[model samples]
Target chain A: MKIETKVEKFTEPLHLESGRILEEFELIYETYGELNEDKSNVIVICHALAGSHHVAGRYADEAKPGWWDKFIGDGKTIDTTKYFVICSNNLGSTFGSTNPLSIDPSTKKEYRLKFPVLAISDVVKAQMRLYDRLGIKNAFAVIGGSMGGMQTLCYAIEHPTFAKHYLAMATTAYTRPWAIAINKLAIESIRHDPIFKNGFYKKDDLEASGLPGLAIGRMAGLIAYLSPGLFNRKFGRDYASTDGLYELFGRFEVEKYLEYNAYSFPKIFDPLSYLYICKTMNIFDAGRNKDKLADSFDKVQGKLHLISFSDDMLFFPEEMEEIRDIMIELGKEKQVTYKMIDSKCGHDSFLVEVEKFKDYVSEILKD
Target chain B: MKIETKVEKFTEPLHLESGRILEEFELIYETYGELNEDKSNVIVICHALAGSHHVAGRYADEAKPGWWDKFIGDGKTIDTTKYFVICSNNLGSTFGSTNPLSIDPSTKKEYRLKFPVLAISDVVKAQMRLYDRLGIKNAFAVIGGSMGGMQTLCYAIEHPTFAKHYLAMATTAYTRPWAIAINKLAIESIRHDPIFKNGFYKKDDLEASGLPGLAIGRMAGLIAYLSPGLFNRKFGRDYASTDGLYELFGRFEVEKYLEYNAYSFPKIFDPLSYLYICKTMNIFDAGRNKDKLADSFDKVQGKLHLISFSDDMLFFPEEMEEIRDIMIELGKEKQVTYKMIDSKCGHDSFLVEVEKFKDYVSEILKD
Candidate 1:
């Protein structure tokens, strides 16, 4: 299916969890399938960091369908034909949304570091406003993984009756210390780059040289997103070429693979947006400011399905199990389901190993 | 046990595995305890990346002991009372050995990137030369962990009769793709820094500014050296400061910990040495010229003990098991012993959690 991105303008101030406000902003989103007359078949899809509103379907000019095209086509797992899927580009994301790269209405200049720090809850609130404007009173389901999963949980807790089913995949209820350290590495890597110019580099300059520091950050982040088993199976000890084995700058097949994927990232993605998103992820504590962690679960009225991958080191299966355990302790196990899928793809399994969880998703949608 | 570093000059040409030659070089080493008559009590210790000859005891100016002081002092696991310990800085390391920072005799300039890419075999050979000069023949044991472990394995294979026992811990026979990818991240992180100046930055400039890029690399490397379980237990979701929770650049307790450790690394470590060592590690294949991996182990004439950590993501327990399994397949099971120590510290377990394996070392030394 071919789809077009749509933008909606809102003048009302968006009060963020950080106590900052975004006075005027635009929500960029895409929809798949048609909205049913009753609008009960709506499914809101949240995107991870570096992800966009284009979750599935093809554009007129692109060859690749979407980041998650595999599970959302006509007869695919998500079955776009039955459900009207809505995915809005997250606030602070670089993908055609009013992010750090967007021109500030008051200053008439790019926000850059001037953009207020965002939280997962703030991003969810912005999306909720879009949902309100789209006339989506009560959606059939809400689905996401990673940072998106955090947004899904916020939706379930903060707005208890918005979505009937909430599917959070490969995520944690809060950003743990291990993951926080990883994010710090990425941010510092970008910050150390001279070309970054304190996040005020010209777009043309960034396009010319590309942020090597950002590339390094991306490379490190990519490794965390993948399992060592997957890497061992994919590249082993293979060389990039035969001649440079003994050279100081020799390339391994794995290094080449990472470089190819990482180096090209900075050319398209904005550095400030990347930095902000990392902060947003690091401070994601669902139970923050609550007397008890179970209090966060007590507010959830939706059927919360926490799906995790066995090999995901960044957000371990135990993290998702903690959410379920909290719900169980609160005698709300009937409202929460936790499933850990066997996968070697690690955290990226949610996007690439859809077959492992598709039947379960179909069953949930059936309910 | 107070110790001082000693340096010895060698005029003889050292042929490297890369077919390059070091015409003249200096080896820096340290010794502890007493060398018995006939030098039969000699125990050589190999240090890993960023490690030096200072394997035990304290210098006059320092308050802390050596990196492995816990297991190397008198009546300790290695038992200095019964053995004389020797540790030499590895060939491309920055710790007082002739590394990239060393002056090239021909040009009177620092070698920098001109330093020949070293293999683990080259490092072992250099240590062997130091052993010969010290009048130590067929020492009781050769021991090390991580890169040091790689050197121990090299000693077992290349100089089979050099030591009676070889103890290699938390290491691999070859640098697999997973580790190669990680090393690439570190090298690239330093390379991306503008101040790195392609490894030619002036010493004064480096001292003044410090390589932020190198710090980022170290931060990433440190995380890999430790397990997520350790980080969770140590830092959890604690904040660096309570006031900056919603700030974009607010630090987590984990971030502060990493920053404190990582930022100080570049001040002392050389970026070029870091890059060269990473390269050396990536291309370390024991069976490089051999027809089969088993052929490399076939030359082992001494008892080989392979130790691994349960939570080591860098070098998995399965990797050490592979070495033992290869020996068993060759009908040389009697020649090798494999032990996996349960620890949450990951690769650093061999260094910090020596108590867990000290008794085993005592038993092995008794033979």
Candidate 2:
């Protein structure tokens, strides 16, 4: 069931760490539940790649509920009755936030590629301004998975005193070579398209971005989502038939699923947006930011819950263990806990797998 | 030192098991060493995808040496002084063999895609005829890797008494789902190319049947020829610094290798010829012809040597072991020896890995 939530547009001119001032920084967000008298029940929900502020409910008359609606209802993991939840579209996101498609006040045109390349830290920093404006001193917990997990770590490292708990799920501290390679291929798919005009094309021409090139992008993403065991389970050279006509007709169900994903991406996503967001995500490195792992975690004043997935090849389970190991070395062991969720969905288990993730969430939050 | 070999062409009209008469089946081949008195020293080397009869030494008056020059000459593992070696370009191959690009006796024009869709067995059948015509009673070994490996297995199954040794490398009894999936994508790359014309385009346009498609095809092949460890070792997301002034460059040396292979293929290869040859290789199945594994090997003339490389994601080591296990089951255990090469090069180790392959050959010959 879709929960009811309130959304309001809050615009504030914020000074960036860079000397330049974003004169009209705007934030779009949705909120659920009531704040306690001491405001200690406030929980922050962060998003991974391609997520928006619509976290738990129907936006007034919209039929489609939020992406995380399954996990944020009254009795869900992020229970609305116990915690006041807030989710916002980060500043550089194409969702409701001011992004490349936003008009620059000085030039009065879409920033497009002209928008300054954003880092996850920059995104987190912008959200901090939103938090300050909302009078939230510290969130009871900051929880996220995948790219959102990266943002949670960045927030905790940057403003540890303001975060009581940090739960990171199925994420890496920084992007790796394999992921960057896939990202490069994905971006190249769009840029090399005959009609892709480097983001200046009209909205009508933008639809072409999803055809063959974007289809390949979705394919690349699918590879990271599923496990080899899944592939083995589904199709093991069991052809449709022996006449050479059956395999010719349709053999592997995996191929059909990939085609579906490729066909669907263009309707919901823009190629340029994918490019920009990928770059921002890649440059996000908390250890690099603070010079060392210990230094990065030292500033954190929050409990860290580092969660990994057994089948997450994109962000390997070993990487998550490394993060936990680092937190221990930094003498923050008391504030840290590591949980691993075993699933066959690989990197995409966080989003695609429901029941298993729900059970894991229940166990993690029980204490 | 390079050993000179005589090259010649032979043609014969053969009746296929399919009840179709293959008339004037032309074969271009090279032979080294004098035939033994009993025609029993013959070692036939089957070519893999896109390879030819020039297994050793350069063509007469040619600038470039043959593919396996380092391992196939004089006192090599096969030992030309004691053994006669024959390498014939497979039928349906673009190399100087009877192919779609060759003139059809019926039409006088290139057969194009009209060439009978071939199976791996067909190629072996034609080679067997070549053997019979040459007055060879037995082959010392039928050795090959990849598609060539398919032929080795086919030779063993189809004429158990003719080939005494089956040295199959980097191949399977049948094409697995992973290989078929990649091959299907490559075919789609060629078929969906606007210039393909469903195999009935203008003669000049037929040249365009698969240019850019060559990229995807070779890219897929390159994946087979590489190990993930080797690719990660060699590439690891290293990229050329473009400075945003020119088109993006390939991310890794391996990617560049694939691009070069892709570009090279379209320059020389006939699109229809590629399709026919790959299709033959894809459907190659020794397992399909016989019910039990022993029934499949019951016809094999002699010993079997199965070789695989470590870290070969394409022809996974697991599949190679399966063939070896089957060979051991039927009291042919003494005749079958399996060796897994410890190399990071993966399946391509068969080609670029000269010293190791040569050593293995010497060791096997000593046995």
Candidate 3:
């Protein structure tokens, strides 16, 4: 269960939907298992917001394994023993990816807000280039959840035959107004931080200076990720201090939990990147020019699998149902499979309900 | 209709559940209609968090009517022609109440963070005192919704015989963890605003300085106040400018709406008061010391009417169902009435759907 990140530099400029270009960029990725002689058993896994490319295994000096270690390991659902798995840090992300926090080649200074705005399609395009560099002509499957799910759909729509299977969990083809509203708050939280200095704050003091705004944004996001039922069962009106200390500020257990995670988020995350990434999510619309979503999926040749969580407030199960209905109307029912995971974990269910998807994943990967 | 705010000063010290005291505080209230002989037709209305004593009618030079003007005028739901109405701002609020922004007589300065933490019972106690000063020994009914609804329940429980009828809408007897989490974000947003200066911000610069945090907090609260369906129906993915003029921000119609309201909120609200009021809401528990919720209601000798919004994410309809079940178990079902308003407006349904409640209110008021 050891993992190491590898970086690849692409000299070609990335033309963004915003009409901006990144002259050159690097993509950091992690690979599990070895590519076969035919390189036919490759699976590309996408990460969500606040997630990195380290989908499985532990890096040296790390206390915890990768985010999806439970689901993607030697003998896990996406068994590494049988297939080559690749997960890369998305563009506009703060990991090892060439994001706003990365140094600008011309100025040797951080891009900060100067970085080009990204779209979900741009993220998929970068990953597609990474695969091409590695000589992966076609991936056996592209699997992801949440923002990752958005990427999976984008990959299928853009490349069509590049991936044999596309599995999207707890995501929508188009961003809903409810989600846009939430993302707006997160962006405003960071922008309102005086220390943000319009996203030009001192890089050395980034964590301390913009921590308040970034933390607030992260707290709101965490609440959206969790279900009220889960919150009630886990921390229902429970006081954090039995001695009546911190009563005015940190009284509830749920408040303390949100505070801790929020405050710690800026330690590793960049506020500018957070704003950029969330803005990308806010404008995500797969069928932007099409009259109907089914029209966009017409070009997709990959087998489509839509997984939705019943308790997810962000990408509600009904939104997933719409996608399923569209596919049926297009007479692509044979190529589509829709599964709803009854859960109380909300949008985070895709990350936490690994066991529930074991049989589904195994069956999908069998071919 | 015309309205005027009146302030009543009580020299007697108000003792709080937190063991703190507010010496010589003031209560701001507005009256609509006329109190009949014996004050038997008097109805005490409670305002929600961020609401003022201005519940009905218009003040001098005002362009807009009070928050509930539509429902409190002569021919409205809470008809002024039939019932004498009184609405007061809560103690820890900015609207002419003795809040954190109120002056400390001894120090001759704003109380700021030095203001004692308030409880829902404390808010109810202050209102009860206001009724005493008004010479209204007993109210015919106490009716309110949302945080105001919480106050209605508190009024009925703490002063069981003070009111003959109790109407609570879109609220719970206890604050849920989900609500606590949302309140925490709002509080954090204000506290993190650098201009807040730990609540010692300059009084003259209050609106301009603490606006960022307060606005962000309000934006979050507004999102919670609305349901996803309402947002979808009202705003959807419609952009503010079809010409793409405001792409970086202010893109979505919902985002623009949230931004406008969030920004304007600080014009009339104090950050400290917002924090205090939300905190008061977080600690609201009607059955604090009781073995069961039914035990808390045992002393009640009034007809109970509970109305919940079907689409309210904050106080779900199930929460109201819990109250109904408890009353039924206690064999008080005959005295208890529960109704759910099918709405897509979320927690704001109580405020927005007044026309729908006209018949229901008329029937309840007949007694």
What DockQ does every candidate get? 0.84, 0.23, 0.67
Worst 10 residues of 3 chain A by lDDT: A242-251
Q: First chain of model 2: TM-score?
A: 0.88
lDDT of 1: 0.88
Residue A362 displacement in candidate 3 (angstroms) = 1.9
Model 1: per-residue lDDT, tens digit, A1-367? 5465799988999998878889888889998888899999888899998899999977779888788888887888877788888899998898888898888888999888889998899999898889889888999899999998999999899988998999999999999988887788779888877778888877777876477777888888899999899999999888789876888778888988998999989877888888999999999999998987789989999899999999997899999999999999989889988889999899999999998999988887687
Global CA lDDT computed for model 2: 0.70
Give the lowest summed-lDDT range of ten residues in model 1 chain A: A202-211
**Candidate 3 lDDT, tens digit per residue, B16-65?**
98888888788989988888888888888898998888888887789998
Q: Which 10-residue span in candidate 3 chain B carries the lowest summed lDDT?
A: B242-251
Worst 10 residues of 1 chain B by lDDT: B1-10
Chain A only: list TM-scores of all candidates.
0.98, 0.88, 0.96
- In model 1, the runs with Cα more than 4 Å from the true position are B2-4
Candidate 2 clashes between residue pairs 3 or more apart in a chain or in different chains: A160-A301, B160-B299
Estimate, for each residue in B327-362, the C-alpha lDDT of model 2 and write its tens digit. Answer: 777667887889988877877788777778778777
Per-model lDDT: 0.88, 0.70, 0.86
| Residues A280-339, model 3: lDDT tens digits | 888788897788788998877889899999999889999888888888888898888999
TM-score of each predicted structure versus truth: 0.98, 0.81, 0.97
List runs of model 3 lying over 4 Å from the truth. A106-109, A207-210, A243-246, B1-4, B106-108, B207-210, B243-247
TM-score of 3: 0.97
